[model samples]
Target chain A: MIDIELAFENLPPWAALLTAFCVFMGAFLTLTGSVGLLRLKTFYERVHAPTLGSTLGTGFILVGSMICFSVLRGRLSVHEILIAVFLTITTPVGFMLLVRSALYRDRVEGNDNVPEGNPTPGKQSAPDAAVQQD
Target chain B: MSASFLPADWPFVVLDWSLFIAQLFLGLAMACAAYRLILGPRAQDRVLGLDTFYVNAMLLLLTYGIRVASTIYFEVALIIGLLGFTGTVALSKFLMRGEVIE
Candidate 1:
Protein backbone atom coordinates (compact mmCIF):
# COMPACT_ATOMS: atom_id res chain seq x y z
CA MET A 1 0.00 0.00 0.00
CA ILE A 2 1.12 3.53 -0.70
CA ASP A 3 2.10 5.51 2.39
CA ILE A 4 -0.50 8.24 2.98
CA GLU A 5 1.54 9.93 5.69
CA LEU A 6 4.04 11.11 3.14
CA ALA A 7 1.27 12.80 1.19
CA PHE A 8 0.14 14.79 4.22
CA GLU A 9 3.63 15.82 5.21
CA ASN A 10 3.44 19.17 3.45
CA LEU A 11 -0.15 20.07 4.35
CA PRO A 12 -0.51 22.51 7.24
CA PRO A 13 -2.71 21.55 10.17
CA TRP A 14 -5.36 24.16 9.41
CA ALA A 15 -5.41 23.31 5.73
CA ALA A 16 -5.53 19.58 6.48
CA LEU A 17 -8.44 20.07 8.84
CA LEU A 18 -10.30 22.19 6.32
CA THR A 19 -9.69 19.73 3.50
CA ALA A 20 -10.84 16.83 5.64
CA PHE A 21 -14.03 18.61 6.61
CA CYS A 22 -14.90 19.50 3.03
CA VAL A 23 -14.15 16.02 1.73
CA PHE A 24 -16.21 14.43 4.45
CA MET A 25 -19.13 16.71 3.72
CA GLY A 26 -18.91 16.03 0.01
CA ALA A 27 -18.84 12.28 0.54
CA PHE A 28 -21.77 12.37 2.91
CA LEU A 29 -23.84 14.38 0.46
CA THR A 30 -23.05 12.01 -2.38
CA LEU A 31 -24.08 9.00 -0.34
CA THR A 32 -27.33 10.65 0.61
CA GLY A 33 -28.08 11.51 -3.01
CA SER A 34 -27.46 7.95 -4.14
CA VAL A 35 -29.65 6.57 -1.41
CA GLY A 36 -32.35 9.03 -2.39
CA LEU A 37 -32.08 7.91 -6.00
CA LEU A 38 -32.59 4.29 -4.97
CA ARG A 39 -35.47 4.95 -2.61
CA LEU A 40 -37.54 7.53 -4.47
CA LYS A 41 -40.79 6.09 -5.83
CA THR A 42 -41.49 8.03 -8.99
CA PHE A 43 -39.27 8.87 -11.93
CA TYR A 44 -39.82 12.60 -11.51
CA GLU A 45 -38.90 12.52 -7.84
CA ARG A 46 -35.93 10.25 -8.42
CA VAL A 47 -34.61 12.58 -11.09
CA HIS A 48 -33.91 15.22 -8.48
CA ALA A 49 -31.84 12.95 -6.24
CA PRO A 50 -28.60 12.99 -8.22
CA THR A 51 -28.49 16.78 -8.32
CA LEU A 52 -27.17 16.70 -4.80
CA GLY A 53 -24.12 14.85 -5.99
CA SER A 54 -23.65 16.74 -9.25
CA THR A 55 -23.96 20.17 -7.66
CA LEU A 56 -23.10 20.55 -3.97
CA GLY A 57 -21.27 17.27 -3.57
CA THR A 58 -19.08 18.15 -6.50
CA GLY A 59 -18.66 21.68 -5.19
CA PHE A 60 -17.45 20.59 -1.78
CA ILE A 61 -15.01 18.05 -3.14
CA LEU A 62 -13.61 20.46 -5.69
CA VAL A 63 -13.16 23.14 -3.05
CA GLY A 64 -11.33 20.68 -0.85
CA SER A 65 -9.11 19.67 -3.72
CA MET A 66 -8.36 23.27 -4.55
CA ILE A 67 -7.35 23.95 -0.99
CA CYS A 68 -5.20 20.83 -0.75
CA PHE A 69 -3.31 21.60 -3.93
CA SER A 70 -2.95 25.31 -3.24
CA VAL A 71 -1.52 24.77 0.23
CA LEU A 72 0.72 21.88 -0.83
CA ARG A 73 2.21 23.77 -3.75
CA GLY A 74 2.45 27.05 -1.78
CA ARG A 75 0.72 28.78 -4.68
CA LEU A 76 -2.78 28.84 -6.14
CA SER A 77 -3.46 25.84 -8.37
CA VAL A 78 -6.80 26.77 -9.84
CA HIS A 79 -7.21 24.23 -12.62
CA GLU A 80 -9.70 22.23 -10.61
CA ILE A 81 -11.95 25.26 -10.85
CA LEU A 82 -12.47 24.39 -14.49
CA ILE A 83 -14.16 21.14 -13.55
CA ALA A 84 -16.45 22.90 -11.14
CA VAL A 85 -17.48 25.52 -13.69
CA PHE A 86 -17.99 22.95 -16.45
CA LEU A 87 -20.07 20.71 -14.23
CA THR A 88 -22.19 23.56 -12.97
CA ILE A 89 -22.90 24.62 -16.53
CA THR A 90 -23.59 21.18 -17.97
CA THR A 91 -25.47 19.34 -15.27
CA PRO A 92 -28.58 21.49 -15.35
CA VAL A 93 -28.82 21.24 -19.12
CA GLY A 94 -28.49 17.45 -19.00
CA PHE A 95 -31.04 17.15 -16.23
CA MET A 96 -33.49 19.34 -18.07
CA LEU A 97 -33.16 17.28 -21.21
CA LEU A 98 -33.47 13.98 -19.38
CA VAL A 99 -36.46 15.06 -17.34
CA ARG A 100 -38.17 16.51 -20.37
CA SER A 101 -37.48 13.39 -22.37
CA ALA A 102 -38.89 11.20 -19.64
CA LEU A 103 -41.92 13.39 -19.38
CA TYR A 104 -42.48 13.36 -23.15
CA ARG A 105 -42.23 9.57 -23.28
CA ASP A 106 -44.69 9.18 -20.45
CA ARG A 107 -47.06 11.72 -22.00
CA VAL A 108 -46.88 10.02 -25.37
CA GLU A 109 -47.76 6.78 -23.62
CA GLY A 110 -50.86 8.49 -22.19
CA ASN A 111 -49.71 9.01 -18.64
CA ASP A 112 -52.02 11.42 -16.81
CA ASN A 113 -49.62 12.68 -14.15
CA VAL A 114 -47.67 14.84 -16.57
CA PRO A 115 -49.12 18.02 -18.01
CA GLU A 116 -50.89 17.57 -21.31
CA GLY A 117 -49.35 18.49 -24.71
CA ASN A 118 -46.09 17.73 -26.46
CA PRO A 119 -43.06 18.90 -24.57
CA THR A 120 -41.16 19.95 -27.69
CA PRO A 121 -43.48 21.78 -29.99
CA GLY A 122 -41.20 22.88 -32.83
CA LYS A 123 -39.18 19.67 -33.12
CA GLN A 124 -42.21 17.38 -33.08
CA SER A 125 -42.97 18.08 -36.74
CA ALA A 126 -39.46 17.10 -37.90
CA PRO A 127 -39.75 13.64 -36.38
CA ASP A 128 -43.21 13.16 -37.83
CA ALA A 129 -41.91 14.22 -41.23
CA ALA A 130 -39.10 11.73 -40.96
CA VAL A 131 -41.58 8.94 -40.26
CA GLN A 132 -43.63 9.99 -43.31
CA GLN A 133 -40.57 9.90 -45.60
CA ASP A 134 -39.80 6.36 -44.40
CA MET B 1 7.75 20.71 -1.49
CA SER B 2 6.24 23.36 0.75
CA ALA B 3 6.61 23.27 4.52
CA SER B 4 3.69 22.10 6.63
CA PHE B 5 1.91 24.72 8.68
CA LEU B 6 0.99 22.35 11.51
CA PRO B 7 3.54 20.69 13.78
CA ALA B 8 2.75 17.40 11.97
CA ASP B 9 1.39 14.98 14.59
CA TRP B 10 -2.37 15.24 15.18
CA PRO B 11 -3.42 17.04 11.99
CA PHE B 12 -1.87 14.43 9.73
CA VAL B 13 -3.61 11.65 11.60
CA VAL B 14 -6.94 13.41 11.36
CA LEU B 15 -6.46 14.05 7.65
CA ASP B 16 -5.62 10.39 7.08
CA TRP B 17 -8.66 9.22 8.98
CA SER B 18 -10.96 11.57 7.10
CA LEU B 19 -9.57 10.49 3.74
CA PHE B 20 -10.26 6.86 4.57
CA ILE B 21 -13.80 7.63 5.69
CA ALA B 22 -14.47 9.72 2.60
CA GLN B 23 -13.38 6.84 0.40
CA LEU B 24 -15.71 4.52 2.28
CA PHE B 25 -18.64 6.86 1.74
CA LEU B 26 -17.90 7.32 -1.93
CA GLY B 27 -17.64 3.54 -2.40
CA LEU B 28 -21.01 3.02 -0.74
CA ALA B 29 -22.48 5.74 -2.90
CA MET B 30 -21.25 4.01 -6.04
CA ALA B 31 -22.82 0.76 -4.83
CA CYS B 32 -26.14 2.49 -4.31
CA ALA B 33 -25.96 4.00 -7.77
CA ALA B 34 -25.16 0.62 -9.32
CA TYR B 35 -28.07 -0.95 -7.47
CA ARG B 36 -30.36 1.65 -8.95
CA LEU B 37 -28.93 1.08 -12.41
CA ILE B 38 -29.56 -2.65 -12.19
CA LEU B 39 -32.93 -2.51 -10.47
CA GLY B 40 -34.56 0.44 -12.22
CA PRO B 41 -37.97 -0.33 -13.67
CA ARG B 42 -37.63 2.15 -16.49
CA ALA B 43 -34.96 3.42 -18.82
CA GLN B 44 -35.07 6.93 -17.38
CA ASP B 45 -34.35 5.63 -13.90
CA ARG B 46 -31.43 3.69 -15.27
CA VAL B 47 -30.08 6.78 -16.99
CA LEU B 48 -30.42 8.82 -13.81
CA GLY B 49 -28.63 6.11 -11.89
CA LEU B 50 -25.89 6.07 -14.46
CA ASP B 51 -25.53 9.83 -14.16
CA THR B 52 -25.31 9.55 -10.39
CA PHE B 53 -22.71 6.84 -10.77
CA TYR B 54 -20.66 9.10 -12.99
CA VAL B 55 -20.73 11.96 -10.50
CA ASN B 56 -19.84 9.70 -7.60
CA ALA B 57 -17.02 8.18 -9.58
CA MET B 58 -15.66 11.65 -10.36
CA LEU B 59 -15.76 12.65 -6.71
CA LEU B 60 -14.06 9.40 -5.80
CA LEU B 61 -11.27 10.26 -8.20
CA LEU B 62 -10.87 13.67 -6.62
CA THR B 63 -10.52 12.16 -3.18
CA TYR B 64 -8.10 9.58 -4.48
CA GLY B 65 -6.04 12.33 -6.06
CA ILE B 66 -5.89 14.14 -2.74
CA ARG B 67 -4.76 10.94 -1.04
CA VAL B 68 -2.01 10.34 -3.59
CA ALA B 69 -1.12 14.03 -4.00
CA SER B 70 -1.11 13.92 -7.75
CA THR B 71 -2.24 16.59 -10.21
CA ILE B 72 -2.71 14.11 -13.08
CA TYR B 73 -5.85 12.76 -11.48
CA PHE B 74 -7.46 16.18 -11.85
CA GLU B 75 -7.13 15.96 -15.62
CA VAL B 76 -8.64 12.46 -15.60
CA ALA B 77 -11.50 13.69 -13.42
CA LEU B 78 -12.17 16.62 -15.78
CA ILE B 79 -12.26 14.35 -18.81
CA ILE B 80 -14.66 12.00 -17.11
CA GLY B 81 -16.96 14.88 -16.27
CA LEU B 82 -17.03 16.10 -19.86
CA LEU B 83 -17.59 12.68 -21.39
CA GLY B 84 -20.18 11.65 -18.84
CA PHE B 85 -22.22 14.77 -19.58
CA THR B 86 -22.10 14.13 -23.31
CA GLY B 87 -23.10 10.49 -22.88
CA THR B 88 -26.00 11.41 -20.66
CA VAL B 89 -27.16 14.05 -23.15
CA ALA B 90 -27.01 11.60 -26.03
CA LEU B 91 -28.89 8.95 -24.10
CA SER B 92 -31.53 11.45 -23.13
CA LYS B 93 -31.91 12.51 -26.75
CA PHE B 94 -32.29 8.92 -27.88
CA LEU B 95 -34.96 8.37 -25.29
CA MET B 96 -36.89 11.43 -26.39
CA ARG B 97 -36.70 11.31 -30.18
CA GLY B 98 -35.89 7.64 -30.79
CA GLU B 99 -32.62 8.77 -32.38
CA VAL B 100 -29.55 10.61 -31.17
CA ILE B 101 -29.35 12.59 -34.40
CA GLU B 102 -31.86 13.83 -36.89
Candidate 2:
Protein backbone atom coordinates (compact mmCIF):
# COMPACT_ATOMS: atom_id res chain seq x y z
CA MET A 1 0.00 0.00 0.00
CA ILE A 2 1.11 3.52 -0.74
CA ASP A 3 0.43 4.59 2.84
CA ILE A 4 2.68 1.89 4.20
CA GLU A 5 5.41 2.78 1.73
CA LEU A 6 5.19 6.41 2.66
CA ALA A 7 5.55 5.62 6.35
CA PHE A 8 8.39 3.17 5.86
CA GLU A 9 10.20 5.43 3.44
CA ASN A 10 10.07 8.30 5.86
CA LEU A 11 12.33 6.52 8.35
CA PRO A 12 16.00 6.84 7.47
CA PRO A 13 18.06 3.66 7.82
CA TRP A 14 20.33 5.09 10.49
CA ALA A 15 17.35 6.28 12.49
CA ALA A 16 15.91 2.81 12.46
CA LEU A 17 19.20 1.30 13.51
CA LEU A 18 19.66 3.84 16.25
CA THR A 19 16.16 3.28 17.50
CA ALA A 20 16.79 -0.43 17.70
CA PHE A 21 20.03 0.13 19.52
CA CYS A 22 18.46 2.52 21.97
CA VAL A 23 15.62 0.17 22.67
CA PHE A 24 18.00 -2.68 23.30
CA MET A 25 20.11 -0.58 25.59
CA GLY A 26 17.10 0.61 27.51
CA ALA A 27 15.80 -2.89 28.00
CA PHE A 28 19.25 -4.09 28.98
CA LEU A 29 19.64 -1.47 31.68
CA THR A 30 16.20 -2.12 33.10
CA LEU A 31 16.92 -5.81 33.25
CA THR A 32 20.15 -5.13 35.05
CA GLY A 33 18.42 -2.92 37.61
CA SER A 34 15.90 -5.63 38.38
CA VAL A 35 18.68 -8.14 38.79
CA GLY A 36 20.52 -5.83 41.10
CA LEU A 37 17.40 -5.27 43.16
CA LEU A 38 17.07 -9.00 43.78
CA ARG A 39 20.75 -9.73 44.14
CA LEU A 40 21.48 -7.06 46.71
CA LYS A 41 21.49 -8.31 50.28
CA THR A 42 19.82 -5.35 52.02
CA PHE A 43 16.87 -3.03 51.57
CA TYR A 44 19.05 0.08 51.47
CA GLU A 45 21.33 -1.51 48.93
CA ARG A 46 18.37 -2.77 46.91
CA VAL A 47 16.98 0.72 46.52
CA HIS A 48 20.07 1.71 44.59
CA ALA A 49 19.49 -0.87 41.86
CA PRO A 50 16.24 0.47 40.46
CA THR A 51 17.63 3.97 40.12
CA LEU A 52 20.06 2.72 37.53
CA GLY A 53 17.17 1.76 35.29
CA SER A 54 15.01 4.71 36.22
CA THR A 55 17.59 7.43 35.66
CA LEU A 56 19.74 6.54 32.66
CA GLY A 57 17.81 3.62 31.20
CA THR A 58 14.55 5.49 30.98
CA GLY A 59 16.40 8.52 29.68
CA PHE A 60 18.05 6.65 26.83
CA ILE A 61 14.88 4.86 25.79
CA LEU A 62 12.74 7.99 25.91
CA VAL A 63 15.24 9.91 23.84
CA GLY A 64 15.47 7.12 21.34
CA SER A 65 11.71 6.80 21.09
CA MET A 66 11.35 10.55 20.72
CA ILE A 67 13.93 10.65 17.99
CA CYS A 68 12.45 7.72 16.15
CA PHE A 69 8.94 9.13 16.23
CA SER A 70 9.94 12.71 15.56
CA VAL A 71 11.97 11.77 12.54
CA LEU A 72 9.38 9.38 11.24
CA ARG A 73 6.52 11.72 11.91
CA GLY A 74 8.49 14.70 10.52
CA ARG A 75 7.47 16.72 13.55
CA LEU A 76 8.33 17.15 17.22
CA SER A 77 6.34 14.71 19.33
CA VAL A 78 7.03 15.89 22.86
CA HIS A 79 4.33 14.34 25.00
CA GLU A 80 6.81 11.72 26.09
CA ILE A 81 8.99 14.51 27.43
CA LEU A 82 6.44 15.34 30.09
CA ILE A 83 6.48 11.80 31.39
CA ALA A 84 10.25 11.87 31.53
CA VAL A 85 10.20 15.05 33.57
CA PHE A 86 7.58 13.67 35.92
CA LEU A 87 9.52 10.46 36.53
CA THR A 88 12.80 12.26 37.13
CA ILE A 89 11.20 14.53 39.72
CA THR A 90 9.27 11.81 41.53
CA THR A 91 11.48 8.70 41.56
CA PRO A 92 14.03 10.29 43.85
CA VAL A 93 11.41 11.60 46.24
CA GLY A 94 9.83 8.19 46.48
CA PHE A 95 13.17 6.53 47.04
CA MET A 96 14.20 8.99 49.72
CA LEU A 97 10.91 8.72 51.58
CA LEU A 98 10.98 4.96 51.49
CA VAL A 99 14.54 4.90 52.79
CA ARG A 100 13.71 7.38 55.54
CA SER A 101 10.66 5.41 56.63
CA ALA A 102 12.60 2.17 56.69
CA LEU A 103 15.20 3.86 58.82
CA TYR A 104 12.57 5.19 61.19
CA ARG A 105 10.94 1.79 61.58
CA ASP A 106 14.27 0.08 62.10
CA ARG A 107 15.21 2.61 64.76
CA VAL A 108 11.85 2.25 66.49
CA GLU A 109 12.29 -1.52 66.62
CA GLY A 110 15.75 -0.93 68.13
CA ASN A 111 17.33 -2.84 65.28
CA ASP A 112 21.09 -2.93 65.50
CA ASN A 113 21.61 -2.47 61.75
CA VAL A 114 20.35 1.09 61.58
CA PRO A 115 22.82 3.95 61.93
CA GLU A 116 23.03 5.92 65.21
CA GLY A 117 21.07 9.11 65.70
CA ASN A 118 18.78 10.89 68.26
CA PRO A 119 19.06 8.43 71.10
CA THR A 120 15.79 7.05 72.40
CA PRO A 121 14.66 6.94 76.08
CA GLY A 122 17.01 4.93 78.35
CA LYS A 123 19.69 5.53 75.69
CA GLN A 124 19.66 9.35 76.14
CA SER A 125 22.25 11.45 78.01
CA ALA A 126 21.78 12.96 81.55
CA PRO A 127 20.55 16.38 80.30
CA ASP A 128 18.25 14.69 77.79
CA ALA A 129 17.01 12.33 80.52
CA ALA A 130 16.29 15.25 82.89
CA VAL A 131 14.40 17.08 80.16
CA GLN A 132 12.39 13.97 79.39
CA GLN A 133 11.67 13.43 83.11
CA ASP A 134 10.30 16.94 83.39
CA MET B 1 6.85 -6.60 2.33
CA SER B 2 9.18 -5.42 -0.39
CA ALA B 3 12.71 -6.71 -0.88
CA SER B 4 14.12 -3.35 0.12
CA PHE B 5 12.27 -3.52 3.40
CA LEU B 6 13.76 -6.93 4.08
CA PRO B 7 17.14 -5.39 4.90
CA ALA B 8 20.08 -6.42 2.71
CA ASP B 9 23.39 -7.95 3.83
CA TRP B 10 24.73 -10.02 6.74
CA PRO B 11 26.19 -7.17 8.77
CA PHE B 12 22.81 -5.65 9.50
CA VAL B 13 21.58 -9.08 10.39
CA VAL B 14 24.48 -9.45 12.81
CA LEU B 15 23.63 -6.11 14.34
CA ASP B 16 20.07 -7.20 14.88
CA TRP B 17 21.28 -10.36 16.52
CA SER B 18 23.50 -8.42 18.87
CA LEU B 19 20.66 -6.11 19.74
CA PHE B 20 18.46 -9.09 20.51
CA ILE B 21 21.15 -10.41 22.81
CA ALA B 22 21.24 -7.09 24.57
CA GLN B 23 17.49 -7.24 25.15
CA LEU B 24 17.88 -10.69 26.64
CA PHE B 25 20.35 -9.31 29.15
CA LEU B 26 17.95 -6.56 30.08
CA GLY B 27 15.25 -9.14 30.61
CA LEU B 28 17.57 -10.91 32.97
CA ALA B 29 17.84 -7.72 34.96
CA MET B 30 14.07 -7.51 35.28
CA ALA B 31 13.99 -11.08 36.55
CA CYS B 32 16.61 -10.17 39.14
CA ALA B 33 14.53 -7.26 40.37
CA ALA B 34 11.46 -9.47 40.53
CA TYR B 35 13.36 -12.02 42.54
CA ARG B 36 14.29 -9.40 45.09
CA LEU B 37 10.74 -8.14 45.25
CA ILE B 38 9.46 -11.61 46.02
CA LEU B 39 12.25 -12.67 48.34
CA GLY B 40 12.85 -9.54 50.35
CA PRO B 41 12.57 -10.01 54.11
CA ARG B 42 10.61 -6.81 54.65
CA ALA B 43 7.87 -4.72 53.13
CA GLN B 44 10.40 -2.07 52.13
CA ASP B 45 12.15 -4.68 50.03
CA ARG B 46 8.90 -5.41 48.21
CA VAL B 47 8.37 -1.71 47.63
CA LEU B 48 11.89 -1.38 46.32
CA GLY B 49 11.26 -4.32 44.05
CA LEU B 50 8.15 -2.67 42.71
CA ASP B 51 10.03 0.55 42.13
CA THR B 52 12.69 -1.27 40.17
CA PHE B 53 9.99 -3.08 38.26
CA TYR B 54 8.47 0.18 37.17
CA VAL B 55 11.77 1.55 35.92
CA ASN B 56 12.40 -1.66 34.06
CA ALA B 57 8.89 -1.61 32.67
CA MET B 58 9.44 1.88 31.32
CA LEU B 59 12.58 0.80 29.54
CA LEU B 60 10.78 -2.26 28.25
CA LEU B 61 8.06 -0.05 26.82
CA LEU B 62 10.64 2.07 25.06
CA THR B 63 12.14 -0.99 23.49
CA TYR B 64 8.75 -2.13 22.26
CA GLY B 65 8.10 1.29 20.79
CA ILE B 66 11.37 1.21 18.96
CA ARG B 67 10.82 -2.31 17.70
CA VAL B 68 7.37 -1.51 16.42
CA ALA B 69 8.29 1.98 15.29
CA SER B 70 5.36 3.38 17.20
CA THR B 71 5.29 6.41 19.49
CA ILE B 72 2.46 5.07 21.58
CA TYR B 73 4.72 2.68 23.45
CA PHE B 74 6.84 5.58 24.67
CA GLU B 75 3.80 7.28 26.14
CA VAL B 76 2.90 4.15 28.02
CA ALA B 77 6.44 3.88 29.30
CA LEU B 78 6.28 7.41 30.61
CA ILE B 79 3.05 6.76 32.39
CA ILE B 80 4.47 3.66 34.00
CA GLY B 81 7.43 5.63 35.25
CA LEU B 82 5.22 8.30 36.78
CA LEU B 83 2.97 5.77 38.44
CA GLY B 84 5.95 3.86 39.75
CA PHE B 85 7.42 6.97 41.34
CA THR B 86 4.15 7.95 42.97
CA GLY B 87 3.46 4.47 44.21
CA THR B 88 6.92 4.15 45.71
CA VAL B 89 6.55 7.49 47.49
CA ALA B 90 3.22 6.50 48.94
CA LEU B 91 4.52 3.19 50.17
CA SER B 92 7.57 4.82 51.71
CA LYS B 93 5.46 7.44 53.45
CA PHE B 94 3.28 4.72 54.90
CA LEU B 95 6.32 2.86 56.12
CA MET B 96 7.97 5.89 57.68
CA ARG B 97 5.06 7.88 59.08
CA GLY B 98 2.76 4.88 59.55
CA GLU B 99 0.03 6.70 57.73
CA VAL B 100 -0.37 6.81 53.96
CA ILE B 101 -3.55 8.89 54.21
CA GLU B 102 -1.65 11.92 55.45
Q: lDDT tens string, model 2, A1-134?
A: 13433444567777767766776676667767776777776776777777878777777777777777788878997877787788778887787778877866765565656654543434654433444353
Docking class of 1: medium
lDDT of each: 0.87, 0.69
- Checking candidate 1 for backbone clashes, the offending pairs are none
What candidate 1 gets wrong by more than 4 Å, as runs, is A1-3, A115-118, A121-134, B1-8
- TM-score for chain B of each model, two decimals: 0.91, 0.82
Where model 2 places Cα greater than 4 Å from the true spot, the runs are: A1-9, A117-134, B1-23
Q: Please tell me which predicted candidate would have the highest DockQ against the true structure.
A: 1
For every candidate, what is the interface RMSD in angstroms?
A: 1.5, 3.6
- Find the number of clashing residue pairs for candidate 1: 0
Tell me the docking grade of candidate 2.
medium
> What share of the reference contacts survives in each candidate?
0.88, 0.68
Candidate 2 local distance difference test against the native: 0.69
